[model samples]
Target: MTASSSAQTPGKKDALAGREDAYNGFLIDLEGLPSSPEALLASLRASEAVWRERAYRGIWLRLPKRLAGSTGAAVEAGFEFHHAEKEYLMLTRWMVEGQPDALPPNASHQVGIGACVVNEHGKILAVRELYGPLRGTGVWKLPTGLVHVGEDITETAEREVLEETGVRARFAGVLGVRQAHNVAFGKSDMFFLVALTPEPGQTELRPQLEELEGACWMDPAELTEQPHFVKRPLFQSMLRACRDWAEGRPAALHQRKITSDDEQRRDLILLRSTGGEDGEL
Candidate 1:
């Protein structure tokens, strides 16, 4: 039988089903960059079943096209690309470092995006970001920006906060790091959860039209039910931060789920109700 047909045959079905379970289990234990199937395979080399599947199929099992598109030789080639990439990383690591664990670090170098903490009172000294992918959007997000070369993360945070929010705030402590995979941008963003110590009163927030359309602070919980929440990881982190702050478990904060489509529509309404122009246009 052909390999495709064999996968559907009764005898092979049972083995493949078991393999599917094992594949998931292997993925859970892998640590390398999983942006691509080949990267995943290289990191999961200890599994013999996975290796055999790759050999029999002549490709990596986790090829994206195999999961998404029509079955064809090209689809199979997509799998092979991943397989070859995995093989290359494996051989290079084995020869150079003598073990996968000895391989060089690949921690992503991130462009710094600033962090801001809205207090228990639900006030955020935010920036009006005017020109970027998110420009002309009425959603007021926490003041954030990329770190220039030679700038420390904390220094970058402090600078961006003051520049964007118009408040001289002190660093409180780290909240946690948040990351999201952007398939459209072909990059992942790492958002640092930072605490900012600000003055007790409402500060005059300004809008740099070059960077923002508008800037202001509204209730954080209000956005939880809105659509703009989908665009702001800072807002999600704020919820966890508030929870931890309330519970006196500041260091125990965990990342929250990304906002859903339903929530986004609600936020759009909330922002528009404020006499703010529609953020989505």
Candidate 2:
């Protein structure tokens, strides 16, 4: 990263060492920051003036919790709270006139995916979690898991089913989606109900003991035997939807190759369908 030309401030060399981003915004480095709030404020003022003179669009700066006391310095320099973390706070300022902020906002949604894996016998694959609210409730649920960063939903669905039930399955397509708020870490969640075909001879029991009490190819009717399972309308609907796909309805889910964040890549797979009833495969 390159610092401003006048960054050599006699004693504090490169006190405002930051580099311009692609959009002409300056991103301040956390290292070599000014020591005290007063010093910080002075450095910020100097940097702001230099950036403005150089036609930089905005400034993005992050301060660790230890230096949170210096937040006043940044605020005094017209920086606004962009977002925050337990360990740090980010502040941003728009230096240009009549243009929108170029930086993207913080992430707000979490995604989870599960698979409805059925065997030739037509029983759905399910698992009983070792600890969550369903531990000993006799409620068998489709093995579901949160999507890891950058993980494809299909990959998450297939992996979760295999990890929880030891069933090798191939991603078929999505069945439906269940959305809820105030879940894990208090974030909103999008749960993708997916359908997977069991790989040949891949049906067996090998429950992951750490996260599951047991796993089985459960008859859909057996779920009703558990009083707790009957009340879960979401799972009930998922069962219905999966059966629809199995019973010769057009696949409700189909994969489309979409462009990834990088403009040059068009191989990211997205699962979509024709509403809830039927879709063209």
Candidate 3:
């Protein structure tokens, strides 16, 4: 798969499906994995021999959660744990003699987007979840969700808001971002507070029945009066920041598409703070 080499597939059809990687390595497909541990071990050995003959640099093996019992066979083949996702575990082996492992780290942080829909009248779109940290608390908060694979923050805001509240909103800009550790799936998360303006005449409420207890247009003052918001000064500060965003005191980040003449990094979309004073940017 490297620039100089031809397709380096296995010499014969083995029990496991394998393909070449861009780095002159082999990646074993996770689907149709052998159910029998003995068969899996034999397949790995055959694939390894083929790659070894071609002087491949490394081998990547993925095992689905259902095939976890076959892990011993992969370990016997000299594979070590690289990382794991919600659905599968990744294993790797260095193939070239004396060449150290040179794989990039797997993704470590998840991005979650929250929609803060402020209308012309300044009422915020809010929902009460049937689960999570605020379940049954009767606290009205922004409709939020995790960003899907290959989805941008702007799309995520519109999709989540429409899903949770049936409100088709216009994506304005980003309000803020919050980072916390040891969150969902034992990974760190970056929660975005996205600013949105509800469609002028389409703000009808249709709360998601399964996951949400209620959804409505809430006055900003009403959020401060919720019992859950009363005792926690931190949440209060968060909402206060939202209020500031609605009033246009603190300029939000605006989205801009940037392209470079360099082919390797062209057409990248970036979110820049409205005020250029952010030295960190």
Best-fitting candidate, scored by lDDT: 3
Q: What is the lDDT of residue 258 in candidate 2?
A: 68
Q: Which candidate would rank higher by TM-score, 1 or 2?
A: 2
Q: Write the per-residue lDDT of candidate 1 for residues 1-281, one digit (tens) a residue.
A: 10232222112211222122222121121122244544344433433344354433222233243223322332332322222232232111112123233323333446555465565565545555676666766655667777776665566777877776566665544566667776224556766666565656636665565666766765655544457765667667665574453333433222222346875631211111222222321
Model 2: per-residue lDDT, tens digit, 1-281?
32444322222443488666667677787886776999999888777657766787778888999899999999998999988979999999988778777666776679998677877777788788878787777677788888997788888888888778778898877778888998866678898888888889987689999988788877767754467746777666777776665554545567765667766776645445664532342
**Residue range 1-281, candidate 3, lDDT tens digits:** 22323443466667355667677777776665788888889888877667777677888888888989988999998999988888988898887677678865677789988888888778888899999988877778989999898788888999999999898997776777889999866889998888888887866799999999999887888876788887888678778877876666543677664556575543424456756543434
TM-score of model 2 relative to the true fold?
0.74
Candidate 2 — which residues are off by over 4 angstroms? 1-15, 21-24, 30-32, 35-38, 51-57, 63-89, 94-103, 246-250, 256-266, 271-281
Q: Candidate 3: where is the Cα deviation over 4 Å?
A: 1-6, 9-25, 28-36, 43-57, 63-70, 83-89, 94-102, 225-227, 230-233, 257-268, 273-281
RMSD of each: 17.2, 5.6, 5.1
Candidate 1 segments exceeding 4 Å error: 1-107, 119-122, 181-187, 199-202, 230-238, 242-281
Residue pairs of candidate 3 with colliding backbone atoms: none
Global Cα lDDT for candidate 2 = 0.76
Positional deviation of 99 in candidate 2, in angstroms? Answer: 11
Could you tell which candidate, 1 or 3, scores higher by lDDT?
3
Clash totals in order: 12, 0, 0
lDDT of 1: 0.46
